[model samples]
Target chain A: ADLQQGRAKANACAVCHGQNGLASHPEAPNLAGQPIIYVTQQLKNYKTGRRTNEIMSVIAKPLSEQDIDDLALWYSSMQVEVKMAN
Target chain B: ADLQQGRAKANACAVCHGQNGLASHPEAPNLAGQPIIYVTQQLKNYKTGRRTNEIMSVIAKPLSEQDIDDLALWYSSMQVEVKMAN
Candidate 1:
């Protein structure tokens, strides 16, 4: 359920963020396997303009806290496939 | 050297993103212990406009590839203190 709503909310995100959350965009960070707390915090930033992105701000502006929670749950639930030295 | 340089780069970031990379800003994502690749990729995104943040983009704009590498190296090298449910 959370994942489903996250996927739905992810529509705007997928353009740059990608369907798998692994961004193909050179600049976009791959969220496929990012920590939920990290993801949640970022979404909050976009909502408040702390980390202002024109598109993301608009998309995030209307999102309620529950909506943010749902999206965070959905994105963080997925496994990250990209491997780099840890 | 990398850590020092990253600390320098982190000045603009620390306002919203805490000195430790755990963001006090509701929307900003914490980067203290994010994966290097993820951090690198996100930095690249801000530089290229894929993920636009006014402050970040400006700060990121002047950063060279090596600077990006250094900052990414520094941030990912730290231990993430904020634990969330995984």
Candidate 2:
């Protein structure tokens, strides 16, 4: 999967998960630095109804296997840091 | 609700959501800095079956209203920052 292409594809995810995978909403999970296997499996689970989430199910439904792989790879490669509130 | 008490109560949530509210897993969201109303509502939804997650539902099942409020306040009071990978 092309990392740049994956990043481009990730734009749609920014509304909830931030541009870099940090979530904009409390309801959405941070995808940055997650294990690619875990990310891939969850997307597949959502797509297959093994796991259910209203938004994730819809988002995962239209993604092809390659798309899923690309997305997982992209997110998993990003770095995440948690900073204390000043 | 006491913020300190809320923080203390939030320890159980740390396994999935990090000790400071960033998630340890992609499956869980960063709860830091969320709108308290949003956090509170989601917890209630999980508690009431309006939203479903294998883990969240189980965790929320035993919470009292005060527990929910304290948690919401604790998480919402936290600060979150997302930085790009170097």
Candidate 3:
């Protein structure tokens, strides 16, 4: 999948997982720099009902395998840093 | 439940969720400042098999209700910031 296409396709995901995949919500996991295998596996799990989250299930339900691959690749390619507060 | 006790019990969780509840692993959600209700509900779901996660289910299985409450409270009280990359 083209990285640019993946970035474009990830617009909806940016609502929760920031535009860069760093997670906008505390309840949402940061997807940037995640292992591609892990991200793909979870998406597949959500799609198959092996892992069920109300929102994730609905979001992943219609994603084609190619879409999943694109998303996984896009997210894994982004970078994130942990900023700790004192 | 004591907040201190919750912090102590959360040592195991810090492997994935940082000591302050910001996730260390991309697969883990940042728990800091999440709604207490959401955190508590998800833990219970994991414990009850309603949410099936290979790691979380096992970790949540033995927690008492009090433990869950403390964990929820502790995590909710923490603060985190989103750092975006350019």
Candidate 4:
């Protein structure tokens, strides 16, 4: 939950999830402002192979418990506003 | 879960989340192939005020527990393949 460390650790995530968790790619979920519990659980799922995505499974493989928490905190700290699909 | 009933109830979600839970909007997460536990928990969060979004909080307000399970099943039944960010 350290903002400074979280930001530093989130660089790799930004490559796909955007600089602020908005998702630069169509296939990636927008992580901005997602619940901390939700985000944390997902990474754990990938790490444990409960959920598998080609890239996520690989990316999540090396994350320690603290790394996962930091990433979740980084994303959760971002803000998002949902505009209904037109 | 009852697939037919789930599909029927998902009509409302289709306007934004797309027919098979591949969201039509960038702001909406792709639900296809997502784990049932994850989807169900999120809806419950929205319902209980543990999570809030302008549209989803209202949409979830009237959903019975059965309705939430059905909807989650419908989305989880769909498939997704990710190609990753370039």
The number of the candidate with the highest TM-score is: 2
lDDT of 2 by residue, B1-86 (tens): 66887888999999987897766786676566666777888799889977677898999999999999999889777655555544
Docking class of 2: acceptable
* TM-score of the second chain in candidate 1: 0.83
In model 2, what is chain B's TM-score?
A: 0.91
TM-score of 1: 0.53
**lDDT string, candidate 3, A1-86, tens digits:** 66666777889899987776756776776566665677888899899988888799999999999899988888767654443323
Note the B-chain TM-score for every model: 0.83, 0.91, 0.90, 0.92
DockQ of each: 0.11, 0.31, 0.23, 0.06
DockQ rank, highest first? 2, 3, 1, 4
- Candidate 4 stretches with Cα past 4 Å from truth are A1-86
Tell me each candidate's TM-score.
0.53, 0.70, 0.69, 0.53
Estimate every model's Cα lDDT from 0 to 1.
0.69, 0.78, 0.76, 0.72
Can you give the lDDT of residue A52 in candidate 3?
85
Preferred candidate (DockQ higher): 2 or 3: 2
Candidate 3 deviant stretches above 4 angstroms: A18-35, A83-86, B1-3, B16-38, B76-86
The segments of candidate 1 whose C-alpha lies over 4 angstroms from its true place after superposition are A1-68, A71-86, B81-86
Residues A1-86, candidate 4: write the lDDT tens digits.
66677778889888877776655665566666655776788888789986667799999999999999988777667644333222
Error of 4 at B4 (Å): 0.7
* Candidate 3 lDDT (Cα, 0 to 1): 0.76
Which scores higher on TM-score, 1 or 4?
A: 1
What overall lDDT, based on C-alpha atoms, would model 2 receive against the true structure? 0.78
